[model samples]
Target: MYQKITVQTKTEVKPQTTAHLAQTMTLLNMGNGEVEEEIQKNLAENPALELDEINRCAMCGSEIAFGVLCKNCMNNQLKQDSQYLTFVSTREFPVSEEAADNEDYFEDGTVDRQTLPEYVLRQVGMELDDREKMVAASILTQLDDDGFVDVDILELASYHHIPISSVERVKGLIQHADPVGVGSKDAREALLVQVDELKRSKDIPEWTEKVISDHFHALLKKQFSEIAQQCEITINQVEKIANFITENLNPYPARSNWGDVRNPQENEMLQLGAPDIILSFFENNPQKPIMIEVFQPANSNLTLNASYHAALKTVDKETKMKMREDLEKASLFIKCLQQRTNTILRMAQVLVEIQEKYIREGDRYLKPITRAEIAKKLSVHESTISRAVSSKTIQLPNRKVYPLSVFFDRSLQIRTEIKEIVEKEKEPLNDQEIVTKLEKKGMHIARRTVAKYRDMEGILPAYQRKEKVKTK
Candidate 1:
């Protein structure tokens, strides 16, 4: 068993250059943007690379060197497109009964809505004498979106150099404000304040009101039978009382009424075009006939001068070696830049072919796609796919295009078949209706799940889509 054994093998491997090693190290260290910056820097230093210009319109057969579109052709295209659709003014219209009702409600002053601080100040102003307005204002300012003051009354009093009793009195005043239940130091107090308001309005019976005011924890935990036994009321009565309490309570009472309305300054138009990469997609065969015109170093006017070479020949050995090293580095950098551009172009072409449906049909047709899928198709790593897509955009026939990254989204619970059913329905389907329809179609789904998918698609809730009939 202990007999001697010998194994012989021969292998050959190519030695990597210092420049190649340096490039590997650089690529490992830098991100996509940094790599792009490095490439541009190399191109500038080399004086060898040049980005080719697209001189003709692919569509109209016209010369358009400086820009992608010819002036005459662009104008004609715009004119033809303009005839298909008309732009509308942003004037207010009575589009829905609910909207009309909302208009009438505001006109009749039925709903008393106020800004957070204003509402707080009104109640505090009423309760507090002129002496404590500053303390009340300070307390109101400290209250957060949930209407709960983060700082303790004593802490606020210490900061303001006011008596703790004054802080408490001001807090009580804010707690009694309209949109009932604001400036409470805690959730318990907020809920109690709301229950008290409901009690005053006689929204619930005396026994049910007591249960809500006292045993809020039991109600929250859905301990309806226990609450009913304690309050000597039916389970049904407890449920009704709980609903009334929920309806009355303002979870974020100190939050401004105008919270739903966005400020115009916040609105921004997302520009979706990459001017750097000149891409052209051929209409007939998009799969194989796409062109990515990258900068070619050979096209540049740079050449090794005869005088410089003659001078170098007469120079010292050290000087000649230095010049050679610089030339080699410059040449290597230009090569690396070209390689990077080629990689990006290859990735883009693959993406266009795979996601052609999204480009042709629009956003509604966008399916659940991923970088992994593209990487597999392109014979590259997932990281490479991510790098290729990052900060890169494509120009399409319809408009200036965005990165292919924008097209890929997570798949919704609503399958393609379910979506088709919803779309083909004569009437708009609410979450519940959609859920019911899905169940009939043998797709097991909950109402909440349906609602979530609708939300993901940016579709509104059933109540929002409901329309009123016109009556004479």
Candidate 2:
């Protein structure tokens, strides 16, 4: 089925004379793991393709003098202020046969692990138009620990100045996401949404929705006899419905597969591997040039097979044509790989410069930036920048690894402020009070947005916080 779909999609694309352009664009969006797999597959399938074990310059193909790049390439990239010194690294490559099994390259594949919100966004991003992306982003960012929207839907509709129905349409799309009931208002809503989804494919009991909607309280309290009487059904029927709900439904959308929402600290998280890029200062000095190391998974350069080229020259005409096709493919793959590396390097240079303070200082200093801003600086499309940053991680000098997308996170500063304000509050401040406080600090945002950010940081509501204070 997967192959059929892939073939169908490929058939839809018009034949292009510029193979390099099409291939490079495809390679640009692939994560490191996917690229490595592509390289390996090419090497196995094409006799003309070869992997050079020697570490060499990605740009000039010269033997690397010291690091990943030759001295000349390094000098050409260096600037007077010395703000950034970015280069690709081959440290992730296996050094010996024994070490290959446990090398960093294998582990680095897992760095693209997505949080729950991100996972959902990937599914829905392509389906949404530009305006709907904003609405979707708003909804996803506001999800609480239970995967329910923390803000009022009407408030969001008013804030975005869109019709309430549009908001519902977007929220409806989210509710059908992986956990199957996320973006719901509460457990009952989530369960009903789940049941609705289940009815499409499964043999669900017809009275399941009725029992949940009309007698949710009684259902929870196990008043099966009363529910049976109200619905004109036998107690045995109610028990069967109860059994189905117990076996197939989860009231908390985030509780299954997701981390333990009840214990926010115990959220299940995937272990991250080596970073795709490392941000540091030259000579480990703050005043020195900033160094960015982009990891090359193969830890080596790819070159054409000289033996195959020689053999091609002496082959029959038909054989020569076939081999030449292989050679062209191999050459194109290498060029695309280099293009991918260069694109990432260019992006990193701009990001490190724009986010220098945020990197050197902390989240409090994060300036509002967007992918469009970076794309403009680089003379590329916004989607190009998005593809380069997607699923990539960067390790800072402080040794904390963060997603490459973090550089473009416009909300980080405000979210940090919200967290700080809550941490130092004299008493529990409601969302409106927090909004007023933010306004005093010159960070004006809607009360609902404040609530969303608060929920994102796992901060309790004012009443909950006050109750906890009383307990203390």
Candidate 3:
């Protein structure tokens, strides 16, 4: 088509490869803390980018320096919590307490933010039998942070060349220990275990156990009539049982109740760093929508220095060219930062929409969602979603922090549901039976896989659970 090649001049656009590659790596891997550090480093090195004086508090979202909360926030906190009064009396209420007290603080100012395994190991110690100590330690280590058991009991037995009963016995011991439901096979099993512990007082509805045991789906669906009919009870009795389950059950037992949690100021901090995202629930609100507040680090407020952009017009040829290149690099860096945030936000919104049930109820309703599936839905590359999720932590309504990557953990969600099904089976569902049940619930997996998940969850198979029931 271009026959007149002699006079034609084409200027091709070439990307700054080194700068782009470095910028991409930074944007994808860094969480808010790292981003802030990078921003500070860039401001020092690159003459083009400058930090706009943000007259705002990063935490309270009021006006102050980027690093600390405003004076008003500090004063209001003093009026509310009497504990801070003594400290405030000695000195003027600084943006925060002095560095002397920083060591006394941990997450929520009460417990260390160690993973579930770490807590369990410390809590259990030398109490277990020597043989049991090893198996118990192994199981606790293999468990996910959520406290759902992840090692297959049978496999562990085979590997250790111990009887299956020894493994099962240790598994039961851990399950019954403090943080009562931590060692459960799944959310359902966790709920059941918690109920068993609570049932000791005998205040729980008599038929509530039956409903949870045999008619879990019906109860969940609010199918009172079906459950009532199956359990030979009136709908009124079913409602009472439903009320019991509603009041007592917790699907995600791993986290503290961020709801009604009153961690004192300075005391309320997460152990690692401030959260990148905050989710607040309004129990009083009519619509019942979660309010998501994304907190960007102070360094995200970078802009091109106006003097440099204006300097390009007045400077000499060589100097102007260099200034123009600097401006371009600055612009590229800002673009990468914005793109990172936008991708994270879009993914988070979609995840919230999909997991609203879980947010309202607890982890029990967390459906099986995968990064690949979300990547497809968002029309972005899986790697992009992965990068956006990397090293990120989210604050829940009750102010509990969780990794952004948690939304993509489908196996944990499935195992949680499976544990529920096995515990609720009228006559314990064997591995094969559980597989059939799981398929009905839209989780298609091999019988062996079902068995494996069951064993990993530390749940005894159908026959063993049945024997226990007969003994009970």
**Backbone collisions counted per model:** 0, 0, 1
**Alpha-carbon local distance difference test for all models:** 0.50, 0.73, 0.62
Per-residue C-alpha lDDT of model 3 across residues 1-472, encoded as one tens digit per residue: 0001010012232454655644664476666656767778888888998876654432233445434334664465456642211100001112234323666433222223444544565666556666666677666644543567555778768755678998887777676666777777786777788788897866878776667777776676799998878888899998987787767776555543322221324443434345666666534352455655455554565678988788788889999888888888788887676556656666667777788777666766787776667777777655456566666677666556666766666566678888788767788878877777778888888775676567657799788998999999
Better of 1 and 3 by TM-score: 3
Best by TM-score: 2
TM-score result, candidate 2: 0.65
**Which candidate model has the greater TM-score, 1 or 2?**
2
Stretches off by above 4 angstroms in model 2 are 1-18, 65-81, 93-176, 179-270
Tens digit per residue, CA lDDT, model 2, 1-472: 0000010101222333456755665577666777777778888999998777565655545565444444654676564444466566665532334324434325444533456667787777887776676677666654555677654678767756778888888888888888899989898999999999988898997698999999998998799999999999999989999999989998878656653223332211223445678888777888777787777666336778989999986889999999999998887787677767877878887888888899888998888887778878777756567668766778888877676777876678999999999899999999999899889989998776787678767899999999999999
- The TM-score between candidate 1 and the true structure equals 0.40
Worst 10 residues of 3 by lDDT: 1-10
Residue pairs whose backbone atoms clash in candidate 3 = 258-398
Residue 408 alpha-carbon offset, candidate 1, angstroms: 2.5
TM-score for all models, in order of appearance? 0.40, 0.65, 0.49
Q: Please provide, for model 1 over 71-160, each residue's C-alpha lDDT reduced to its tens digit, 9 standing for 90 to 100.
A: 544465356642111111111212234433443233211122233554557655866665477566555544443566644677657645
